[model samples]
Target: MGNDGGSIPDRRDLVRTKAKAEQADKANQTRARWFFCALSKRRLEEPIVACPLGRLFNKDALLEFLLDRASYGADGAAVAGHIRSLKDVKELKLTANPATKGKGKGRGEGENEETPKFVCPLTFKEMNGAQPFAYLAPCGCVFSLSGLKSLSSAKEKEPGKEGSTTPEKDEEQLELCPQCGAKYSKSTDIIPLNPSPDDESLLRARMEAKRAAEPKKSKKRKAADPESSDPPKKKKSSPTAAPTVNPNIAATSRAVVTSLALEEAKRKAGMSDAVKSLYGDPSKPKQKETFTTMGTFTRYA
Candidate 1:
């Protein structure tokens, strides 16, 4: 429709224009996760350790966070407070990428950067968190999950190999590490790096259950280690224990006790006969209430 004495308004002209905000760059986000400490946000360096949640951190940064949690502020505590000690994290045995090793390193340089600091020896894929990665608990060797499966599949394909036969469901089947040839259990050793929230919860539950099942030697450790053990309890002496003798006295303890009894008797014997009569003879049975009755003290009306 034509506007009276004016140009017809187009849909674009009618709608108010709004500037769209730029979203975060995916490449930068990926690089931040793969190359920086999740806690300290500094460039990742050795000796690096990964949490049960799969996030990576510098060992020194974790130590500092543990030592003074308040310094990192609230977010740091929430990010790493789950890490109570060094035992909570395992040091990763990472293979340096040969492509990047020979080149000089510079901080904050863009694609000008040569390569990812580390890579999977099996697939040669850079550990940039683009794909799944895992580390073995026993050997601490890291490898991409796809590479591990490929190696496993390759073994199974070998003719007459035991892996080619039916797999065993043994609770503790020891598998050799492809990288180091170290023995590890497949069911428990393979820990995913930087796992998703759901996977992290499962890993955390498994960790807690395993720890709870573990034979707690902390009580024993405290008892055995002198520095950690409580001070030895002292033996309590009885009140009637062997009479103590004055160090300056030449007489024995028994002699001192005997002398004290004799003196007490003599002092009583020296009491006047009238004063002594107030107390009846010890040989006679004591009256129920010579001076006062224990009950019914109110006088009869």
Candidate 2:
């Protein structure tokens, strides 16, 4: 067909247009692939300690034996080396998959997207960071100590400067967990960043309260006389009247009493004579025994 000015384009023109479109599409695909590869490669190269997975990898083990301990924290080189070690172990299947693959819309999607176990409690980020403490991995999630005390104080409603005493003006002052966004009270028990004044104050208050609760010693009382002590006193019994006796029995008793009195008088006389001889005084008044009763005496011719 001859070239009609407004007619449909020839087969060659259509072919050219299709070719250019395909080239453009191929370029876009290449760009996207490079972008994804760079991003993935960067993530793979990032320090494991900076990622939540670092907690599982054993930082001390890696540091003491594998990497330098002094250079472990905040060291880009050490972090990179640690990450490479992890990648090698994972690729070799030395370390089993710590995370379970989540279900996806398609078969490959599940394998591509795996969710990690044991998320960071502080950051709620992908648990990427150094072990024990979360740090930002190149993967974007991190556990940070920066502003941790401030963050905690904010949650406790006591936000202030490093040493300032300003109470938390509002709840917004505290830093919420980036993951679960849970709030914590200001204390060392919650956050390990730095010592909080609230914790110190609480400790001091507890000590004071304990001291106040303790029992006190009482003052001593004066001693009292032994005679006037609380124990009861004994009473003396009065003398009883002499009993009446039969004539025979009275007579016999009188005879026995007379003999006993005579013997006793002899003993007293001897002792008195000895005492008089020693002192050279014979007429001294003799000691008398007081009598409780008197009996009738009988005389024989």
TM-score of each: 0.63, 0.19
> Of the candidates shown, which would achieve the greatest TM-score relative to the real structure?
1
The segments of candidate 1 whose C-alpha lies over 4 angstroms from its true place after superposition are 1-30, 98-108, 113-115, 159-166, 169-171, 223-273, 276-301
Scored against the true structure, residue 281 in model 2 reaches a CA lDDT of 42
**What is the C-alpha lDDT profile of model 1 across 1-301, one tens digit per residue?**
4777687777765552321112245557667778888889998999999876677899899999989988689978878888878888889999888767555354346643536789998998988878889998877899999998897667667764454445674335577899999988878778998787788898889887776555246735655465343333111222223233343354666688889879657755875654344343444334324544313221210
Model 1 per-residue lDDT at 288: 28
Give me the displacement of residue 52 in model 1, in angstroms: 3.3
Flag regions of model 2 displaced more than 4 Å.
1-118, 122-153, 156-301
lDDT of 2 by residue, 49-69 (tens): 221122223333443434554
Clashing residue pairs in candidate 1, if any? 54-194
Local accuracy by lDDT, each model: 0.73, 0.36
- Give the 10-residue window scoring lowest on summed lDDT in candidate 1: 233-242
